[model samples]
Each structure stands twice: as structure tokens, then as C-alpha cells.
Target: MPFLLAAALCSVLVSVLLKLARRLEVDVGQAIAWNYVVAAAASMLVFAPAPSALHAATAAWPALVGLGLLLPTIFLALAGSVRHAGIVRSDVAQRLSLLISLLAAFVLFGEPLSAAKGWGMAAGLAALTGLMWRPSKGAISGGAAGWIYPLLVFLGFGVIDVLFKRVASAGVPLGAALLAMFVLALLVSLVLQGWRLARGTARLGARSLAAGLLLGLLNFGNILCYLRAHQALPGRPALVFSGMSLGVVALGALAGMVVFRERLSRINLAGLALAVLAIVLLARG
Candidate 1:
């Protein structure tokens, strides 16, 4: 339970830091590249994932490479979402991404669809619609920009989940897959950062460096604690899943509404409730 709580806290804190990045003059791209450096190092130290495992005969190169590409790309989208949309909607939307994976399970992977999951999917779609709505000007500063990034976050994470499932299906260990993905993602980030530096669009800043280091720690903490939570409650997968998801939504709502003072409409609040319901139904299914 402590691990679950820590995981949820770390996840939301990542959003909070991103929200503060622009104000702090932190170059998010540079920070993200550095984050992978720390994350990949932590992966190697903690998981000790082998370098050769990535090229094993059974390795799922497509999925691994896709993750390598998407992790950092979607991370940028996540930063945009946090900046444009309030943390509440962004966090809920992220949790609701499981709907995409659930659909893929039924359609692509031939998993049996249950009534609860069907209802959950329906509610999740509705929740997404409502969450993306900007009924009031106070919802977010930019009208369309508010929803676009959150939508991207939703879709991008959903696809990442599908890719992760593919890697899991390939029988490669999760730790090895993550390490490979992180290393590849680091390389991708560096290439992009290098290009930006060459074009004079970005500069190396101590602030960005500091933020990136902290971001890496929080990001790695989130994954590590969640994994530990699952290990702690191996017999109760639902508990860990629900705890992590709901905990994020709840904590994010508090932070966004109370601490950040972000505003939302009644419809948005209804969407929040639906998101909670969808999560419960999905967990039960």
C-alpha cells in the first residue's frame, strides 16, 4: 500500500513539475532527454537488464522500437497536456487510456469481452468526451489547445500500452524491454536535442538540467513503486490497479483544484465522476 501511494504521488508530481517548467524557464526537451539518462541508468542498476537480451531471437523489435520512440514523444505530449489542460482532466484521461488497451484486447488479441468491460468502455468514451469539453473560459487558457494535448496524451498512452502488451506477449522480461526502450529513447532524444542545438533553438541550461534530473528520479520512482506494489499484492491485482489509478485521479484532483486552483464546469465534474466509474467497472471486469 505504501508503494502504491508513493507511486501515485510520484506520478502526479511529474505533472506538477512539468506545469512549473515554463515559469521556471526549464527547457522541457532538454530536461526530458536528461530524464532518460537517469532513468536508463536506474534501469540498469536496479533491474540489471542485459544488453544482449534486446537482440535475442525472441525479442520483439517492433514493439521495443515503438516504445523507444513513443515514450519520449508521448512524454512531450504529456508535458503539453499538463500545461494546457488542468492536471485533473489530464490525469483522468491518462487513466482512462486503459479503454484503448481493453478494446485492443478484445479486437486485436481475441480476448473475451465481458458486459462490465463493455459498459466500462462506453463510460470511458463518454468520460473522455466530457473531460475534453471546455464549457467555461476558466477551464483552461487556450480553448482548443486545452483538449488537443490531453487527447494526444490519451491516444498516445493507449498505443504505448498496446505496444507494451506486445512486448510482454513476446516473452521478453519487462525489465529488459524497459531498459532497451529507455536506451533507444535516450538516443532519439539526444539526436533531436542535438539538432535543436545546431539550429540555435535550444541551449544548455543549469535549470533544465536540474529539473531533468529530478524528473528522472520521480519518473523512475513511479515505475519502481508501482512494480513493488504489484509484487506486494500479487494475489490482488485489482486492488493494486484500482489503487494506483484512483489514487492518481484523487490526488490530482486535489492538487489541481485546491493547490493549483484550476477551474472546471459542471459537465467536467460529471466527466470526472464517469471516469471514476469507468475505472471501477474496468477493474472489476
Candidate 2:
């Protein structure tokens, strides 16, 4: 339970760090690249001696590689989503990823879905619809791309979750698997950023680097807590993870209102309420 709470807190911190990065004029791309680098380093330190057994656990290699390719795109989409939509709306949209993941788990892994889970899914969908129902007439950036980014982010994260579960179940030590995954993701991010740098389009200045490092550290904390939660409770990580997601979104909403002075529309407020109820149902499930 304490581990779950830590995971939730870490998730909240990640959201807050991202919000701070935006406020500080940090280059999102560079920061994201640096974030992966730091996160890889942190994971290595946590699981120092890369075990030879991990080599034998190569059955999930393809999935891990695919995940590596998807990760940077996920971050890019999430950053873009936050840029176009506010944090509250972006997070609300992002939580919809859970539905995708749950369905994938059910179909691919044969995870069971009870009546409570069904109710939870319904509530979550309601929340997402409410959040996205923007009635105000204003020119939002990214247009159609804005909507696409969040959905892509959701798909990417769902893929990662399914892959991670498969890898973990296939005899890979959680620590080793996490380290390898982060390292691969970092390499992908670096190559992408390097290409941008070569074109003189990417900024690698001090502020961006610092923000990236901070975001990376926070991300490391989140990964650590998540891995630990999974390790400690081998079955039904979804409940704990759903709780963490709710905590992060709630905290993000609060920060949005307090620090950014962002006003929530009636629809958004209703979305928040529905999200809370969905999490409760999820936990019960």
C-alpha cells in the first residue's frame, strides 16, 4: 500500500515537473531527449549488474524494441497535447489510455473483466467525453492534430503496458527489464534529438538540459515506484495503477488551477468528478 502511494506521488511529481518545464520556456523536445538519458542512467544505477539471465529472456525482444520506438513519439504527442489543450484536459484525455490497455489485456492476455470493471470503464469514458466537449468558441492550436496527438499518446502507452506485462511474465527480472527498456528508449530519443541538432533546429542550451534532467529524475522515481508496486503485488497491478493515475490527474488539475490560474469549464469540472468516480469503481474492481 505504501508502495502504491509512493507511485501515485511520483506520478503527480512527473505531471508537476512537466507543467514547470512548460512554464520555464524549456524546449520540450530537447528536454524529453535528456529526460530519457537521465532516466536510463537512473535505472542502471538501481539495477547495477546487468544480469546474463536477461539475455536468455530475449523472447520479448521484438516487443521491447517496438516499445522503444514508440516511447519518444508518445512523449512528443503528450507534450503537444499539453501545449494545445490545458493540463487538465490533456490528462483527462491521457487517462483514456487505460481503457485501451484494459481491452488489450483482456483480449491478448485473457485478463478477466468483472461487472465493476465494466462500470469503471463506462465512468472513464464518460469523463473523457466530458473533458473533450469544449463548447467555447476559441481558436485552439494544433486543430485536428491536437486531437490526434492525445489519442496517439494513449495508443503508445497502451502498447507499452501490454509489452511490459508480457516481458515481465516471460522470466525477465523486473529491474533488468526496466533498465534495458529505458536504455533502449534513451538511445532512440538521443538519435532523434541528434538528427534535430544536426539540422540546427533543436536547442540544447543550459535551461533545457536542466529541465530535462529534472524531468528525467522525476520520471526515474515514477518508474521505480511502478516497478516496485508491480513486484510487490504480482497480481492485479491495474487497481494500484489506476489509483496512481487518478492521484496524478487530481494533483495536475489542482496545480493547473492554483499555479496557472486556469479556469475549468463546467464540462471539465464534470469530467474531473467522473474521473474520480471511475477510479473508485476501478479500485473496487
Candidate 3:
């Protein structure tokens, strides 16, 4: 339970950090790029992954490569989402990605679609609709891309989940697989950042570096704590998953409202409520 709570806290902290990037004058791209460096190093120190598993005959190279390409790019999308949308809505949209993973389970993995899960899917879709609904008259800095970024975040996370599942099915240990992704993502991020630097678009800064280090720590803590939660309760994966999902939503909302003073429309609030319901139903199913 404690590990679960810590994991959720870490997750929300990640969102909050992204939201604060603009105000803190932190270059998010640079921060994220540096984030992978810190994360990859930490993975090596903590996980000590067996190099042999990667060379095994049944290695999930395709999935690992996919994750390598996607992780940093999706992280950029998430930063855009949080920058454009309030943290509350962004977090809810992220957690609601379970809907996509559920569909993948049914279609790709041949899992049964129970009635409760079906209804949960319906509710999840409606929640997404409600959250993305905006007043037609509003002319803010964000236009169509406001909603588009969050949708990307939603879809991107779901796909990442599927890729992780694929890797797991290939018999790779979780620690090793995670370490592999971090290292691969780090390489990808470095290349992109190097291009940016070459173009004179962005320069490496101490602030971004510091922020990235912190982000890396929190991001890794979230995963490690979540792993601990599951280990502590081996027979209750559903409980651990649900707790982490729900806790992030709840705490993220609080941080958005109380700390950031983000305002939400009635429809958005309803969407948040429905997102909670969808998670509950999906977990039970």
C-alpha cells in the first residue's frame, strides 16, 4: 500500500513538473533528453540487468525498438498536452488509456471481453469525449492541437503498454526490459537533441539539466515503487493497478486545482467523474 501511494505520488509529480516547465523557463525537450540519461544510468545501477537475456533467441527486438522510438516522442507529446491542457484533464486522459490496452487485450491477445469491460470501454470513450469538448467561442493560445495533444498522450501510452506486454510475453525480465528501453530511449533522445543543437534551436542549460535529473529520479521511483507494490501483493495485481491508476487521478486533480489554480468546465468535471467510474469498472472486470 505504501509503495503504491509513493508510485502514484511520483506519477503526479511528473505531470506537475511538466506543467511547471514553462514558468520555470526549463527547456522541456532538453530536460527530457537529459532525463533519459539519468534514467538509463539509474536503471543500470539498480537493475543490473542480465546482458544475456537480450541476446537470447526469443528476444523481443521489434518491441524494444518500437519503445525506443516511441518513449521520448510520446514524452514530448505528454509535455505538450500538459502545457496546453490542465494537469487534471491530462492525468485523467492518461489514466483512461487503460481503455485502449483493454481493447488490445481482446483483439490482439485474445482475452475475453466481459460485459463489465465492454461497458467500461463505452464509459471511457464518453469520458474522453466530454474532456475534449470545448466552448466553440474560446480563442486561447491552443486551438485544435489542444485536444489533439491529449489524444496523442492517451493513444501513445496505451501503445507503450501493449509494447511492454509484448516484451513480457517474450520472457524478458521486467527489470532488464525496462533498462533496455531506457538505454535505447537515451540514445534516441541524444540524437534528436544533437540535431536541435546543431540547428542552433536549443542550447543545453543547467536548469533543464537539473530539472531533468529530478524528473528522471521521480519517473524511476514511480516504476520501482509500482514494482514493489506488485511484489508486496503478488496475488492482487488488479488491486495494485487500480490503486495506482486511481491514486494518480485523485492526486493529480488536487495538484492541478489547489496548486495550479486550474479551472474546469462542468463538462470537464463530468468527464473526470466518468473517468473514475471507468477505471473502477475496468478493474472489476
TM-score of each: 0.98, 0.88, 0.97
Put down candidate 3 lDDT per residue, 47-109, tens digits, no spaces.
888988888825698999999999999999999988888788789888998888889999999
TM-score, prediction 1: 0.98
lDDT for model 3, on a 0 to 1 scale?
0.89
The candidate 2 region of ten consecutive residues with least summed lDDT is 133-142
Regions more than 4 Å wrong, model 2: 1-5, 138-142, 229-239
Clashing pairs in 2: none
- Candidate 3 is scored at a TM of 0.97
Error of 1 at 46 (Å): 0.5
**On TM-score, who's better, 2 or 3?**
3
Candidate 3 Cα errors over 4 Å, as ranges: 137-141
Positional deviation of residue 224's Cα in model 3 after best superposition, in angstroms: 0.3
Tens digit of per-residue lDDT, candidate 2, span 55-146: 88879788778778777778887777666665676676666677777887778888899899899889988887776665546344456665
The number of the candidate with the highest lDDT is: 1
lDDT of 1 by residue, 155-184 (tens): 999999999999998888778988888899
